[model samples]
Target chain A: MWKSKAKFLFLLPAVVWVLIFTIFPLIYSLRMSFYNVRIGQGDVFVGLNNFARVFTNEQARSAAFITLKIVVIAVAVELVLGLALAILFNRAMPARGLLRTILTMPLFATPIAIGYLFFTIFYEEGGLINGLIPWKVPWLSDPGLAAISISLVDIWQWTPFCFLVFLAALQGLSEELYEAARIEASSGWQVFRHITLPLIQPTIVIVLLLRLAEALKLFDIPFSLTGGGPGTATQVYSLFTYRTGLRFFDLGFASALSYIMLIVVMIIVSLFFRHLRQIYD
Target chain B: MSRKRKRTKGIIILVLAVAAALWAFMPFYWAISTSLRSPLETFTIAGLGIPFIQFRPTLANWIDQLSIGETQRALLNSTIVAVFSAVIALILGIPAAYALARFRFFAIKNKDITVWFLSQRVLPPVVTVIPFFLMMRSASLLDTRTALVLANVTFILPFVVVIMRQTFADLPVELEESALVDGATHFGILRNISLPLAAPAIAATALIILAFTWNEFLFALTLGSRQAVTIPVHMAGAVDTRGVQFWFMAVRALVAMLPPTLLALFAQRYIVRGLTLGALKG
Candidate 1:
């Protein structure tokens, strides 16, 4: 009995750490969302009023919709780029080791640093990209281009992460399956389509889901690159939350938005995870 | 009869693959060259001009960023946050991982624990930021190293637990069981047997987690203030200031990435393995 108590006692530090640091705060936010809370004012219990305000606010709704657009587009482009790189590097070719190392570079690159690099790449005057194009696009100052530019930086930095997962999955594939496909006179594209892709299907789905969740939470590149401007043009969900909570000090509304995001992500991951598990075999 | 033709086709495919990889690698090369080049060369060179050979290389920008009070302080701040989180993560993670590996606790299966740990990473930082800020303020930890470290442990703990679970799972359990038969306690068995056996995997996971924490930006930017600002947060402030141009801030940004970039190159193999854990398990 004493030893069992001691065992549970040893678990106390970690439990206490998480409770004090994470779980307690999550509960606090839940409580805050029920009140009319701001930075400087006494909280008044206004159950569900903050959530109602979130639904009615056109700016907040638009920001949420815009965030959806960014996530869908960014995740799609990165999926394609990442999967393609994975397949390319999986082939038995020269310098495959070196290529894999280079491909993973962006994953380790500091995101803010990448944002700074793209700031130069997409600048209007005296930028490398400006020289490549016949017309100057005002990549930074223009509203539409700014969103796309941020997404592009995200792709540059994170596509390698997806690539790494898919590459590992690809290498784990049985070489015998490819040899068997060859015996059946399968074309190169057909073998890749029917055999290799299906074999790594689980990794693809997992990578896609993780990237989708991550892209929805994006803050750094857009914040550093454009600061949710030219005029709220590239504002993503995380940025919206930041502006609402920090800039406006509307903790109640921000918490509501966050809960909404939590629901959306939970739905997406839960729906796909079952199918993802089946593919692993 | 067709052997020579097949070999020729293989050679062609190899050439194309190499060309494609080079195209992919060009941006990284550009970043390295841009960081190394002098400011005069950066302005004088045209598109696609190789920044390295076209002008004199100087460490002035690197020195400038290093010498700046805010930049140096931020670097030290990031180092502290990263090291603190890594230590906390390991301490919390290894035991949970051991239990999940060696024992069945309260009907929670191994897969369930793995899934639970992974979900933490999937939780968007935005979801927690509002609550986290209020929690920090209430706890008197806002805008300090402790707040950043604690936030990181939450952000990174699941990863540590998951990777360490794999490490523990791969280790032979019989040795520890034998230790137990010799009247060794759970803690004693782990300290003497399991830890030494799993050292390489643990080291690998630690390196990867450290890299991830070092590169983490959002929470670090939000939760940290002047005294606790990380390199990324500091660079954000530098870039966001009204009059700052790309040149001045770019120098700072490039300087900030040096330690992490070097770490990544050295641990590239472990990183690939670590990031891809449970990827096959779906």
Candidate 2:
């Protein structure tokens, strides 16, 4: 038998790395959140004031609202579209491999690059959609449309990811398992309805939760697309936090806001994941 | 199934697939077409600016983007940081993954321990970026690739551990247990049997982490701003005084996007197993 002491060695480096980088910083930022941190002037401790401002401030509230809106819309559309595509592709299709490779091209694209790509495409005057049409639509300029545009871009990018994962889940179902189900079923769709859906339900839940977690952290598209402009129209929660801490140098409030973001995400993830854990454990 | 009905179904699938492919291809088409156009010719063409038909495609944007020293430096730095970050993560994480897969710890459940490791990822980078900025600034690592790599390891390590843990768990434990009975050490078994079996997963994980580190922007933008700028940061700075340079931005977007996209395509075969975090594998 190996030394009991040596057993700890394998896990030590990861623990140390997390402590030094992740845990330390999280705690350090927790302290910073209580202070009124600014540029040039020294930090002044103002306990819960930053937290109070996060709740009261119009910008923060609106940013929160907009982020929620985008997350809900984008994730919903991605779910529907992705599931349909995945279900459609579960069959033996011609050139399936090539089609999959092509469809999933946007999955690995830089989000900021998507921001820029869509910027030009949606640029009212000489832009692609406008140039192709007779009307010069204000895609990025209109306040209501900008956030919708952001959701569209997210849908464009992540729908393929959902499709891929769902397809994998569907494809992973063994033929024997399906054959057994098929014996009791009258038609093909009945097999999917009775067997495939139930089997992949866990995967469905996980993918949905994964998409939700990521959607909550939305930053890149809005940051590059509008730069939180047209009067903070598309300024998401992350972008607002970035501007508060980095650009505005109000580190304390940003810290508090980020903490709140962290806590909210943790709560959401745990609530969702508790049910999922039973499937694996 | 009737032959006519099956044939119609195939045709429908083909048409739908082609339509989906076009939607997928639209962005690349726009970016590449934009990159090839001169400023004067950008809006002149009809029907999404078909090159050579409406206007001659120019290499000026590519030449302009590539000739910049910052572009070259950013490319080099991103390569260095991504490669080093991926390697360090694999080194630190694979051992832990193996341990989790094989050993039952004294106190903590392996499940709980695994969850703790995964929780590190759930903490958004923004939550950690501020303190990291302060810390990096104090340590004088603000503009170094080392700092970027370290910060990257914080997030990427969990992926390696969780995915590789699943990979190792999937591997037949019989061979390892038999090897142990034959007087092989646990480390020896991992080295000779577990690692070789898990090599494809390892390679796949490394490539994914590499692509991620390469495409990373937030930390690189904050921590490695000047001297250690990455492709994403460089691509972000593609704008000039005359508003956003669509052509140049297109060129830069293509440059930054091509590597990760190609790397992901190469790794796509493993992605079904690798990325689902073993949820489907069960």
Candidate 3:
């Protein structure tokens, strides 16, 4: 009995923290969604009105769609590039350690710095690409190009992350299995298809699932980069929430929008967990 | 020789890897280059469309940002918030980690706790903004270093607990039991035995929390105004205060990146394991 009490005491700080910080905020946001609370004004209940406003508002709908689009594209691109680099580096290679260290350097740079540095690099004529390749690209000015360009910056910083993880997973593979396949006169592609892919599939799933969550919550780069556009072309859901709640101080409506985002993210994360479990089992 | 062929293959891989490294590092290189170049050199190089340095360097921008009272204050605020937050997180988290790793408790599941903690990382900062602001307002903690520290602790604690639990679990428990048999109390066992073994992992965890708090923009942006702004918030404020001198901002940006970057270098080896949260769990 005494041992159990001591153990429960050990759990108190984390429980209290979660209660105050996470669970309380979640419940507070839910309650706020049902009320019409503005900073200067007092709270008044307005049930379902905030949700109605979200569904009917075209701008809100557009922001939701744009957020989904960015998540899908950016995550897909990171997975592919990360997997490829991992494979490339998996080969018996000289300077692999040095290369990895260099590539991972960007992972430590703050998103604000990345956004600022890329802003200069993507400048029309004076940028690095423009100087080297001799063709002017309006990397930030054009609306359609802006989202993709920012996504590229995220990929640059994060792809090395995926590379390192995947490399670790790949190195964990048993060389004896590959040797066995070779002894059986298996072709390289056959060996990779039969042996390597199956072994690394779990890592791939974990990587993609984590990256998807990250991409969906995208804010910093776009916030500092285009500031939600040449127009609203780059407005992710997070930025939309930021603009509504903090910038405009639309607490009630932003709370509703945020709740909607919360539900969507939870659903996606659940699906990702299911996929990960499938790989594991 | 077949061995010679293998060596050439290794050389080719090396060249390819080097190329990828250069591509990955270009923006950071550009940032440093822009920071070091003088205003005249910045414009001259910009006009010529050169990414690399082609002229004399200067420390004018670094001196300007560093010498300014407000910028220095922001840096001090950032240090206070980050250090205090990380320290608080460790204090609260390490014991919790030990409990989770070493014992079973009523209504407490380790995996559930870990997932719950990780999910907290995914919670949009905006979700907590309104409520946390209110909490701070009622407590009269707004625009103070304590507000920043508590707020940072709120975000950082979960990750630390999850990672430290893994770190503690990985350490052999016999060390502690052996101490316990020698009549050492629970606290003493924790202090004398577990801590020394887990120091590397604890330091790594501390560095990550420090980096996150240091670079945190949203909470600092919302909670801090005038009085307790952090370096990132300060850097963002720089956008309006001084219009982009490309060169000047670059230097200030590098200054901002310095501490976390150094921490990353010192803790680089433990980083891979720390980051994945020992996810390659057997």
DockQ of each: 0.45, 0.58, 0.48
Cα lDDT tens digits for candidate 3, B1-282: 999997887787678788889888777777777777777666457433333336666667778768989888988998989999999999988888777777765564556666666677767677787778777878988899898888899888877877787777778877777876788877676678888989988998899889878888777877888899888877778776776668867876787776786787666666666555446532
Clashing pairs in 2: none
Worst 10 residues of 1 chain B by lDDT: B273-282
Rank all candidate structures by their lDDT, best first, as comma-separated numbers: 2, 3, 1
Over B27-116, each residue of candidate 1 has an lDDT whose tens digit, in order, gives 555565566666666656767656445666667766766788987888788899989998899998888766656665454445665565
lDDT of 2 at B228: 89
- Displacement of residue A235 (Cα, Å) in model 2 is 0.4
- Model 1 TM-score is 0.92
lDDT of candidate 2 over B106-179, digit per residue (tens): 68777777777877876777888889998999899999999999989888898898889888888888888889
lDDT of each: 0.74, 0.84, 0.77
lDDT, model 2, position A200: 84
Per model, the share of native interface contacts recovered reads: 0.43, 0.54, 0.40
Window of ten residues with lowest summed lDDT in model 3 chain B? B44-53
**Model 1 chain A weakest 10-residue run by lDDT:** A1-10
Taking all chains together, each candidate's TM-score versus the true structure is 0.92, 0.94, 0.93
- Of 2 and 3, which scores higher on DockQ? 2
Which parts of model 2 are misplaced by more than 4 Å? A1-4, A38-42, A174-196, A275-281, B240-242
Grade the docking of candidate 2: medium
- Poorest 10 consecutive residues by lDDT, candidate 2 chain B: B273-282
